[model samples]
Target: MKLRLIIIFVILAVPNAWAGSQSQAEPQHEPAEIIKFAKDVEKYAASKGARAFIIARMGRPEKDLPDGIMFTHTAIAVYSNITLNSGEVLQGYAIHNLYQTAGSPDKSELVVDYPVDFFWGAHELKAGIVIPDTQLQQKLIALIAAGNDQALHNPKYSVIANPFNSQFQNCTEYTLDLINAAIYDTLDIARLKANAAAHFSPQRVNTSRVKLMFGSMLMDDVTTKDHKGKVYTTTFTTIGKYLQKNQLADEFLTLNSKGEIQSL
Candidate 1:
């Protein structure tokens, strides 16, 4: 059941979507072989200065009926993110398709098989573990698992849209974004709320910027000049405004009534 709602994705499997460590040193692999070769390549990549490679699935329970055929399938989803030496980043995912076929042959029975496995070329066939920081990725995984369905709807936290269908757009990325938003937003807020004597304005227009731990996307803080070409109020919404390119994209532009600048 591919629901149309935004799913905070911890992981997903998408068409041709993958992120792998770029290693001229690592052994070469065919596109179709990536999934099956995950374990081996991950180890090899780790040895060759690649990041961590992980796999996760999503689905429901299997039900057995009177039929002799074994029919069991879950909404399968997978994700992979890796970092390179120069600090480049790649990420991708796909949704698992589980189903069965009736009357496969003359025999009176059904067969359990995936009719299709969603993947895309632009998304990479796999992801790397980001080898240097497994602990950080694991911590993020824990945070996402802790969030319930209700938590996904909150604006304060980056909404995890449908990862499987949203092209690996899981809540995991949103949560990561929020974490960054908090860091950058808080730093900016500190400057905005400083006393007049401690006031330090941005030297250039729209120079204040925010970045992510992985450098996936750069969400710019709202900034402009006054009629006199002076940097005026640099409003900050909260410390953590949830960093989605669209949702809280304009986050740092606004301020709460309290004027303390909320921190996520």
Candidate 2:
């Protein structure tokens, strides 16, 4: 499960690639203080090399910020929309991001799905997470258009961490939801065609390139996604409608702070 979600995370990491921020103009921050903190995070992700997509969001919290400790925190959404050296872009997206809080003075963690997809890969992509579930989508639209920030921030609307922490300055009770694909570079086109025969459905799709198919699987405890190691009453169970495309970047999706598609 972890591997699957991780791979998808990388592909989804690119969209809306990590958002950029201009330093705070409100309060005068010391020049040295800002530079050192900035270097720490840049160094952290830089150590990961050039392949992984690293998106970092730095900002202060709206509630309960610590003293003496700089309030800005970093969440690294690492992604890898890897395309082989075919000299051509692959038809789909990939994902594998893990968020990290890389600031000073004692409070940091690697949030699995915070902030949003930074594009398709490290340095080159930052569009957003791409999602296929229609049901999950409608709910997001309603929440964003619900008119008031306080209302949208209602516990009932929380589905994932606000990837754009700048918009919604708070942690959430919701966990990120995902979807992704595995690319096959099988040699035998004949074998691939034969496999497509079994799953292909008469279901006409708007997608081009691959044969379409259908099936259903039981999500035994998907409702438990929000359990977080302990049970809590939740109306937040995710209902997934899964499907695959012959050619499309596979990725995870969640509602960003503004409830826009976090991964595009």
Candidate 3:
């Protein structure tokens, strides 16, 4: 009976980390509150004059997340001229994401959304923000503008994907790929992976092996085949560390629901 309960807990809890793009079926907060917070995040980024930056959202409650994992969904947000419903063009930030397909957690698609839409289904109103150095920022903008972001995308999705290979990719890993592509100025994924293996420090997943094994058995997106030893995957915090270590970031901080900024 204890083993059965453990399996059931794994089935229920594991997917929260593995499937970062899954949205809550119902709104957790009021629409007005969500929209206000999203705009606040945008305002903060704009104040920093960020042309392109890394953004993260909390898709699950803080207490439920595993150690070393701060945020769930990470993506790139580029400043752009957006066309609205009434054919009006306005300058704002557009987010690029790797969201798991509805009803297909194992598959993913690249999606571009605005701040309001990006945070609409968030489980928490907090955000993780990282603005790259000016030169790298320009490179990121150019890469996305030139449509190279799609070139680096791998639709083979995994929650705990190995960053040292091309077998599987999660949202944070994809963000890292884009950053490396910008740094190296090449779309060569092989070279990118090699560089990552050499320089990047992925977040180690701190969870029981038994739970992970059962999660792999029960969930399509929770497989550990790509990982050989201890499970390590790219995360928002790790990305910040990489950029800060190499002097690629101008700012790395967290934006709370109260519009306060705290350096990470």
Show how many residue pairs clash in every candidate, following the order shown.
41, 42, 0
Judging by TM-score against the true structure, name the best candidate: 3
Error of 1 at 221 (Å): 21
Assess each prediction's global lDDT (C-alpha) against the native. 0.23, 0.25, 0.88
Worst 10 residues of 2 by lDDT: 208-217
lDDT of 3 by residue, 9-120 (tens): 8786664553457533356789999989989999999999998999999887787787888899999999999999999999999999988888888888999999988888
Question: Candidate 3 — what's its lDDT?
Answer: 0.88
List model 1 lDDT by residue over 1-264, tens digit each.
353221212122111011110111132335545344443433343344422222221111112111211111112122445354789975533222211112211111111111123211112232212121344334434433453212322222111122112112222322223233232333232232242114222112121122111112211111121113332221111111222222423222211212232212
Top candidate, metric lDDT: 3
In angstroms, the error of model 3 at 15 is 5.8
Model 3 RMSD vs true structure: 1.5
Q: Candidate 2, TM-score vs. the true structure?
A: 0.21
lDDT (Cα, 0-100) at 2 in candidate 1:
50
lDDT of 3 at 174: 94
Point out where model 1 deviates above 4 Å: 1-31, 36-135, 148-175, 178-264
TM-score of every candidate: 0.23, 0.21, 0.96
True-vs-predicted CA distance for residue 129, candidate 2, Å: 19
